[model samples]
Target chain A: MVNKFSIKNLDMYYGDFQALINVNMEILDKEITALIGPSGCGKSTFLRTLNRMNDLIEGVRVEGEILLDGENIYKDIDVTKLRTRIGMVFQKPNPFPMSVYDNVAYGPRAHGIKKKAELDEIVEKSLRRAAIWDEVKDRIKKNALSLSGGQQQRICIARALAVDPEVLLMDEPTSALDPISTLKVEDLAEELKKDITIIIVTHNMQQAARISDKTAFFLNGELIEFDETDIIFSVPKDKRTEDYITGRFG
Target chain B: MKKKINFKEGLIYGIIGVATLFTIGILVFILGFIFSKGLPHLDSHFLTSQFDSTSAYVDVKLSEGTENPLGLILGEMTLKEKGSIEKQVIVVKDIEKTSLAESAVNNKGQNLAISKNDIINRIEGENVEGKSVDEVNQILNSINADKVTLRITKQGGGIFPMLMTTLMMIGLALLFSVPIGVLAAIYLVEYAKPGRFVNLVRFATESLAGIPSIIYGLFGMILFVMTLNFGYSLLAGALTLSIILLPVIIRQTEESLKAVPDSYREASFGLGANKIYTISRVIIPTAMPGIVVAIILSIGRIVGESAALLLTAGTAAKIPSSLFESGSTLTVKAYTLAKEEANIELASAIGSVIIIIILILNALSKLLSRKITKI
Candidate 1:
């Protein structure tokens, strides 16, 4: 398997507070990697660092190297281009207050795709990939906010997919969803892993073990352990990881 | 179980209700008074004519030692001159024979008959011929004639020029203020860091809003009218009004921009869109309804503003041919009518018109906000 992202000695700080310490991980292409921890464990912060979404926040300082395909994302890449190559789905569904068609087409339109027919194709294909085309095809012109929460989340996924990014970062994308919607998003994520690498930060242990090929355990801004998902669940080398997975502590 | 009433809560509610009713009552009473006094006089003629009555003056000479020297009663009578042409001329309705000037010649060197119902188109040696009615009246009045009759032909009543000036002021003020104010607001809300300088700027804007509008008028008079030599023109008045409107526009626009969710910015940025694109497309469109409401309210302010315009826009009751020319808005015209001319009915009519304009603007803003939210 080819490595999609390589992080080396990464440390991140928000002013005086350190959110992520010296962490290192290699994310493989076309595989689902899950980061699991309790609340405020810096998993979400680490996920944001993949796409540099943390740059939007004030007083954030990052050090060390995060390489995408052997190119340093921080030093050698434009932030906009990097973001286009790596898309993010937030914890809550945030569809723009516009038509569903417009929400899906916003990314491509921003990137200078103007022709109606071409945009139509991209919108339909993206909605299909997000597994929401059939449900929203009839009401495509309606405002995206008018939809159910689960449907809105799916539309947001379609919006992210419209730009055709190589990597997808999901920060607790199912935390705001009900059980059925969570299952649908999980299935969609599994199906999407055949093409693009996905990095998901989830708190649910069963979810981390179920779909992810590789799992990384984090505690207090430090990476405790990283291994194959089955091995991490069955036999963890570190006592903290074993304790966290076996429900002794998080 | 029986529930007990809280005295404090009931007292607070009673106070609030009375205050609300008091406010509404004052507004209704004022509107009722203005409409009742003004609407009867607000006709098409009143809206379309000048504010002064049209008058024509004629000089008459009485022979010495004549009886009934002041008995020559004057009335407007149409007479047919050469070629069967009919024209409105001030003629003598009743004259004593002893007051006749047999050798009197008209200004045209033709023999004049001092009989009753004779046409008096000109006065001797005054050069009143071939001049406009206003000039002729002025000349006739300047002569100090002992026997002159002023004949009023038309009543001055219209507010057309004032209405136009008010509309133009609203347009020009918005033109000057909206772009600068909205841009300033965007910068403050989106780009400026929350620090000493930004806080100071916000404080300054708030202070500007609270300053009396008459002070703005004084400043505008010194800057635009005296220094710039605009000389009490519509442009000067509009510029002054623009300054008065700036703080309001900036504050409202900033509030609207701040109301836009940070999630929208995140979403747009995550899609590789630049800040300009994100703001123009996502943020501005969402905040448009609020901005529109702000503009409408600013227009209402412009319509009702009088003191600042009175100092800058001179009270010229005529249609301005250019921006440099003087003009009067509805409020300023009403002020002049009520204070200088003491024409209460016309002033009340102007006040009613201003009220109607503000009501329309309020309704329009509500409708627009609803439509935008629906979209």
Candidate 2:
């Protein structure tokens, strides 16, 4: 398998407080990698670093190299181009207060796709890939907020997919959803990893074990273990990882 | 537990109900008084004519032998004249038989025998010679056995010019202020760094909103009317009004912009959209309903404003031929009519018109906000 992202000696700080420290890992292409940890353990922070989303926060300092396809994202790639290649779905279901069609088309429209037919094709295909086309096709012209929470989340997923990014970053995307909706999103993620590399930060350990091919256990701003999902769940090398998976401690 | 009477709640509810009723009662009473006093005077003629009263007169004489000769002549003239002669009246100065016969040759040089009927027919026919009422009165009074004057008077005319000027001022003021206010708000909310400078700017904006409008009027008079040399004109007035409206627009726009969810911005940025694009497409559209409400309220303020406009836009009482031309808005006209002319009826009529405009604007803002919310 080809490596999609290579992180070497990454350290991030928010002013005086260090959020991520000396983390190193390789994310494989076309695979679901899950990062599991307790709250405030820097899992979400590490996910934001992939696309430089942390740069939006004031006084954020980073010292490291995060290589995407052998190009240094911080030093070489423009932020806009970098973000275009790496799309993020926030924890909350945030569909823009517009029509579902417009919500799906927002990414393509931003990237300068002016042709209506092309946008129509992309919106439809993205919605289909997110497993929501059948439910929302009739009401595509309606405001996205008018839909139920699960439907809205799926529309958000479709919106992220519309940009056709190579990597998808999901930050606890199903935490706000019900059981059925969570399963739907997990299935969609499983299907999406066939074509796009996905890095998901999930609080639910079962969710991490179920969907991820590779799992990385993080605790207190440090990555304790990184291995295949089955090995991490069945026989973790580190005591902390084993304790966390077995619910002995976070 | 036994069911107990909630006397405290009842007392509070009664007090609230009375207060609400008191407020509504005052409004209804004021509106009722204004409409009753003003509606009768608000006719098509009052709406369409000028603002001055004028009267015209013509004089004539009568023979002595005829019974009620003055009344007969007026009745005959009314029947023969093409226009309404009801407004015109004939005043007989004298009645004498000898002088009438001697000056029997009418002003038209037509000979008339010494008969009352001939004189009446001549007066009713084209024998009267004079263009203006004053000239006719002079000639008829000069060669008189009996002299009469035909007088016609028209009361105060309409407020058409004032209405036009008010509309134009509103358009111009909005044109001047909306863009600057909205852009300033965008800068404050979206672009400015959270530091002392931005906080200072915010503090200054809030203080500006609290300052009295009369101070703004004096400032506008000095700045736009004198320094800029726009003079006492609609352009000057609009410029002044725009300054007065700026703080309101900025505050409201800033509030609405701040109300936009950060998630929208995040979504837009995640799609690789630039800040400008995201603001223009997502933020502005989301805040538009609030902005529109602000604009509508500004329009209401413009409609009711008198003191500021009076200093900048002189009370010319005519339609402004250009932006630089002096004119009076509805509020200014009302103020002038009540203060200078003491025409309370007309002033009340103008007040009612202003109230109607504000009510319509209020309704429009509500409708628009509801519509935009649905979208």
Candidate 3:
């Protein structure tokens, strides 16, 4: 299987604080890869470096290469164009205070798709893909912020999908959700991997085991182990990974 | 300790209540005073007519030879043919015939002219021309019956033109300020890297907000009116007022833009939106309430603006035919009436209108913001 993103010897720094150190990983295409770690373990930072989102923070620096489909993102890719191909869903859903249809259409609109019929089709298809079309179709003209938290999150997912990205990066996408919403999002991730690669950062080990095909465990700014999810859960590679999985210590 | 804390809280609450009452009391007092002074004088005709009682028409007839010679003032007596029974109100202008009266005595020394002041006050209400000798004396002898030499002047002096001028100045000032102020705020908040120069710019804006408006008026008079040769015009006043409004709008817009969460910007950028697109689409719409408040403040300043406009925009109480012509806003008109003419009742009437305008503007802002935000 081809890797969608291959990071080699990656290190990230915030001013004098080194947040990620000598990280190397290969994210396979069309599969759900989960990053699991305790608090302050640099899993979120590692995820951000893949899409160059850390570039927004002042005094932040990155070393080494992250290649998206064989091209170094730092050197060759335009940040805006790169983001379009690798859309992100944040930890807390951030929907623009616009209509539901507009929130879904925002990405395609940003990419210069102006025809109404085409945008309508894109919005419908994206909402369906996000598993929210039936719940919202009647009132797509209503403000997206008026919806429930779970629905808003789904709409945000639809928004990310509208741009037709090949890779979807989710940063603890269900951490803020209730149990039912979390399960729904887990089911969504499982269903979504057939079309596009998904990389998720989650604190719930059970969640990682249930939905992810591959799991990478991070400890103290370092990737301790990367393997099939079952093997990571059942078998042991390193002591810290074993400790983290069994809830012995993190 | 709990009892003591309760006493302190009660004391603070009492202070707050007193302060609120004081503010409300002042507002009620001013409104009551203005209404009492201005309500009786405020009527439709006073509000609708022009500032001056315009002279429309006068009855002048060429007088025959007389010893005083005040009546021989016209070269020709071509009466604008009207039916003897016709009665109509005509707009009277200048009623002078002295120049024509001089040329009437052509080479021969014959009294063929009527003097300019020999106005025949033809009473149109009754047939005084065909009156019997006794009846004519009775009409003249009676103090108020069949009066001759009617100088029928129309009721004049209205505040309508001043209201129009006030509206025009407000429109022009808002046009000049809003776009420039919003753009400047966007640049300062989003684009400019934080440093000493940016700090200096912010400091200058704050300082400008504190300077007295009279200073701004003087500066505007020197720069826009005299230096730029705009003269005492609505354009010059608006331009000056725009400068005064800039610091206010820029500060408000900047604060509103800053209030937009960083997460929104991140989301927009994460979705492939450029900086300009994110600011225009997401940020500005979210910050609209604060911007609207800024605009409302600017309007209040423009409407109540007297000191600045009096110097820059002259107090000519005519409906300006062009932007370059001078005009007076409501505050200026009231000020002129009160200070120069000492017409307190009329000034109070203008004051009442201004208060009503401010209320309408505030209500309009509320309606508009509610419509846009749906909140």
- lDDT (10s digit) by residue, model 2, range B1-375: 122457777788899999999999999999988888788888776676556543333344455656443332221222223353442323223335434442334344554323221212224333442233454444444544565433333333578888889899999999999999999999999999889989998999899888888888899999989999999999999998999899989998998899888989988898888899899999999999989988998999899898899999989988899989999999999999999978788888988888889899999988977866664
Give candidate 1 regions above 4 Å deviation. Answer: A246-250, B1-21, B48-155, B366-375
Q: List the residue pairs that clash in candidate 2.
A: B49-B158, B58-B150, B59-B148, B60-B148, B61-B146, B91-B148, B93-B147, B94-B146
Please give me the DockQ of candidate 1 compared with the native complex: 0.45
Question: Of the candidates numbered 1 and 3, which has the greater TM-score value?
Answer: 3
User: Candidate 3 DockQ score?
Assistant: 0.54
Candidate 3 residues B1-375, lDDT tens each? 999999999999999999999999999999999988987777876677668643222332333343212222122122222254532232222334432333343123443332232222233344343334345334434533221232333445678899889889989999999999999999999988888988998999999999999999999999999999999999999999999999999998898888788878888888888988898899999999879988998898899999999999999989888988899999999999999988888899889988988898888777765755553
DockQ winner:
3
Which tens-of-lDDT digit does each residue in A168-205 have in candidate 1? 99989998999999999999999999999999999899
Candidate with better DockQ, 2 vs 3:
3
Candidate 3 local lDDT, A68-105, one digit each (tens): 99999999999999999998999998999889998988
A125: Cα error in model 2, Å? 2.4
Q: Residue B93, candidate 2: how far off, in angstroms?
A: 32
DockQ of 2: 0.45
- List, in order, the clash count of every candidate structure: 0, 8, 14
Among the candidates, what TM-score does chain A have in each? 0.98, 0.98, 0.98
What ranges in model 2 sit over 4 Å off?
Answer: B1-22, B44-156, B368-375
